[model samples]
Target: MTVADTPQAAAFRRQVLIPLKLRLFLMQKLPMAWLAGLRLRQLTPEQAVVTIRFKFLTQNPFRSIYFACLAMAAEFASGIQAMMHVQAGGPVSMLVVKLEGDFTKKAVGLIAFTCPDGPLIAQAVAESCATGEGRTVVCTSTGVDEAGDVVAIFRLTWSFRAKC
Candidate 1:
């Protein structure tokens, strides 16, 4: 079973996200798909908000945010939110079996993806911990760019399993 679905697990997960320096360094080292300026904001028990600036220097010269980059942003936010929902006792292996995206519009400015559909994640996480059975959690990925316009909508599906 996983540890992150319970109150104890959530609290423990919060403890592990405390290293700002490490977080920043890792952000910098990650592949180009992620905007180094990615910022995470906590909204609620089952919600997570991630913000990223569209930078020309790190992007293609076409003067538009790349589709793959946007997809990565959505995927990363979803994975982290899922991880935060489980395994507070220790780390777990996560995988993305299926993912679908709808490009609503081009990301114009700093973009934010909200995990408003967190119930699916929270419920699946709780169920996994209770039964020690692995399952998939589905979450929505909504992206809005700097102009306060919708840039993309995505459906992220992830399968969680204990790292043991």
Candidate 2:
């Protein structure tokens, strides 16, 4: 069976990762996410979503959300998926080797970023475990504004290596 199908991993995600307070605790430790008021809106084996509110701290001089804050939220959306896979499968070291962001428009109000490639990531981690080698996956995070307009698209290349 695949690691993602394991019961223990599934339990951990539902009982631990799904709770807002737990997610908040994690975000609090991350200074940028905390400053941006990032929230974990949803997390599953198939997708992860994060939101950052447009506030004074996150706003730029142009009266829009800072690009960095948007990038932070987008990274979280993709990173959280990798975290889930690592948590479920086994010990693995993961990092964002590269990041590419496209700001299509001004980010205002509440901005939500979604990554819908969790399953693919899980498979890659499983392969890495089996081969005892590192794997890289390019995950896409799409950011949308409160009005449902596309604000930005972030592509993050995450590398995962199994622990020795």
Candidate 3:
């Protein structure tokens, strides 16, 4: 069975699909993301979409969403997928080891960041768990504006290690 079909992954998916549960998760575990108004728009076995809007809390003096906020959304897009995979299997620790971002346009209005690297992340997590060694994968998250224009691209390298 696919990682997403596992009971733990299914449970995590259900928890995230509920807006109130997701909000409470962010409020308790990630206050900055909660304050920045980050929202998870979609989550699937192979993809995740997160959004951030240009609001007072997320905006910068430049009249646009701050770069850090954009990065947070992008990271969440990939991180959520990794989280699902980690939950599907045995205990594993995940962390973002590196992050690189490229801004192609000003981020205004609602920006959606999508990551289509769930399978890749799943493999890494599974390998780490099986081998009891660390594994790393680079997941790319692309951000687009409301008009469908590319706003930013972020490559986040995540490391996973199985726990004893």
Candidate 4:
């Protein structure tokens, strides 16, 4: 059986993964995220929503949010879902193997990055555990402006492997 296919692991995920305090502490450690004013607005087993304020720190000379800052928010949205899965299943190693971004519209004001691919990530992890081989999944995170317009879309490829 996979490490995450256990009752204890599920309990740990419930008690540790979805806590606001832990998320706040995590943000503190990520200085760039903190400086860019990234916030974890919501997180669940199925989705994660992250936001970045288009303030001076996050803005580029073009009067829009910096590309890197947008990338950071998008990554957080995608990564948080994978984090939840890995935390619940067992000690697994996960990394972003690839990233593709489309700057659809100028990112202005507060941007919300939303990713809804938790089930897909969980399946990839289970596959890796069953096969004892690495599995990769592509997750898409979309950034929306405060006016609900599409700002950017990022496709991230994540590789997962169970620890030996």
Candidate 5:
């Protein structure tokens, strides 16, 4: 069997080649973007997990993760989770009025922030929708490094209002 015609080669071509090609296209070749090719997979209304590969440009000296990147990840996780709760026809936008962060350790690998479903988001959305006014919700997110160590903790308070 020739290399091009081998079954294993064909499988690799399908699985590895196509995804890599798509990644390069979307990540490098695109101009109009919001996500910057960040994957939102393993996410849901109750939870948000972001995977960021440590890149030099986005990292601090000593190969440590950047604080700004940690902040971004926190916002992404909390905001997306909150937004998804409003997908059932309830809100305009979440205005982050106040937020605080506590950096505990140096992050050197991918991090995940998870906030599950509960009264907090519901209360915030409900209050905003009920009055057609705004309410505040404080959401906390913790980022863990590759070793499952707490790298950072963030708290965001948002003023929410219904678009309807």
Candidate 6:
């Protein structure tokens, strides 16, 4: 069966779809994201969307969202898909080995980060699990403002390794 068809993956999607459940999950596991008001707008096997707003807790001195907060949202856009694949497959460890970001515009209001590399991540996870080796994939997440202007681009390299 495909990774997305797995029961665990379905459960994860369900959990992310429910606002209260997602908030509780974030509160329990990712307190920082919860505090920063990161929200999962969409999630699928092929893509994921996350959003963050510019507020007191997530803004910078320059009156824009902090770069670190933007990175967190970008990472979550890709990381949630990776987590689903990992849970669908056998035991595997995932980590962010590298992160690169390019800011193109001032981020204000609400910013949405979308990552469309879920298939790549799933393949990497499957390869790692099958070969008992580690595999890495670079997932690009793009953040845009409400006007659909590109605000930032983040390339995150995720490594997946099978457990012994």
TM-score of each prediction: 0.77, 0.90, 0.97, 0.86, 0.72, 0.96
Ranking by TM-score: 3, 6, 2, 4, 1, 5
Per-residue C-alpha lDDT of model 4 across residues 85-126, encoded as one tens digit per residue: 776666789999999999989988889999988788888987
Clashes of each: 3, 0, 0, 1, 0, 0
In the range 42-118, model 6's lDDT, one tens digit per residue, is 99888999999999999899999999999999999999999988889999999999999999999999999999998
Better of 1 and 5 by TM-score: 1
* Candidate 4 whole-model C-alpha lDDT, 0 to 1: 0.82
Query: Per-residue CA lDDT of candidate 2, range 1-164, in tens?
Result: 22355665576567645457655766667766766678888887888889998899998999999898898999999887887788877788999999999999999888999999888789888888888899999999999988999999999999999895
Q: How well does candidate 6 score on lDDT at residue 13?
A: 89
Model 6 / residue 5 / CA error / Å: 2.6
lDDT of each: 0.67, 0.84, 0.94, 0.82, 0.63, 0.94
Residue by residue across 10-127, what tens digits does model 3's lDDT show? 7999999899999999999999999998899999888999999999998899999999999999999999999999999899999999999999999999999999999999999889
**TM-score of candidate 2 to 2 decimals:** 0.90
Q: Compared with the true structure, what per-residue lDDT tens digits does model 5 show for residues 1-164?
A: 11112343234234323445535544664322123333443444345575555676557887876777677767767765565555544545678899899988887767776545324765677678888988788888788878999888888887788877
Considering every candidate listed, which one attains the maximal lDDT? 6
List ranges where model 6 is wrong by over 4 Å: 1-4
**Could you tell which candidate, 4 or 5, scores higher by lDDT?**
4
Cα shift from native, residue 62, model 5 (Å): 3.5
Off by over 4 Å in 1: 1-35, 89-92
Best by TM-score: 3
Report the error of model 6 at residue 133, Å. Answer: 0.2
Stretches of candidate 5 off by over 4 Å are 1-37, 117-119
Model 2 scores a C-alpha lDDT of 0.84
After TM-score superposition, what is the CA distance of residue 103 in candidate 3 from its true location, in Å?
0.2
Candidate 4: where are CA atoms >4 Å away?
1-24
Model 5 has an lDDT value of 0.63
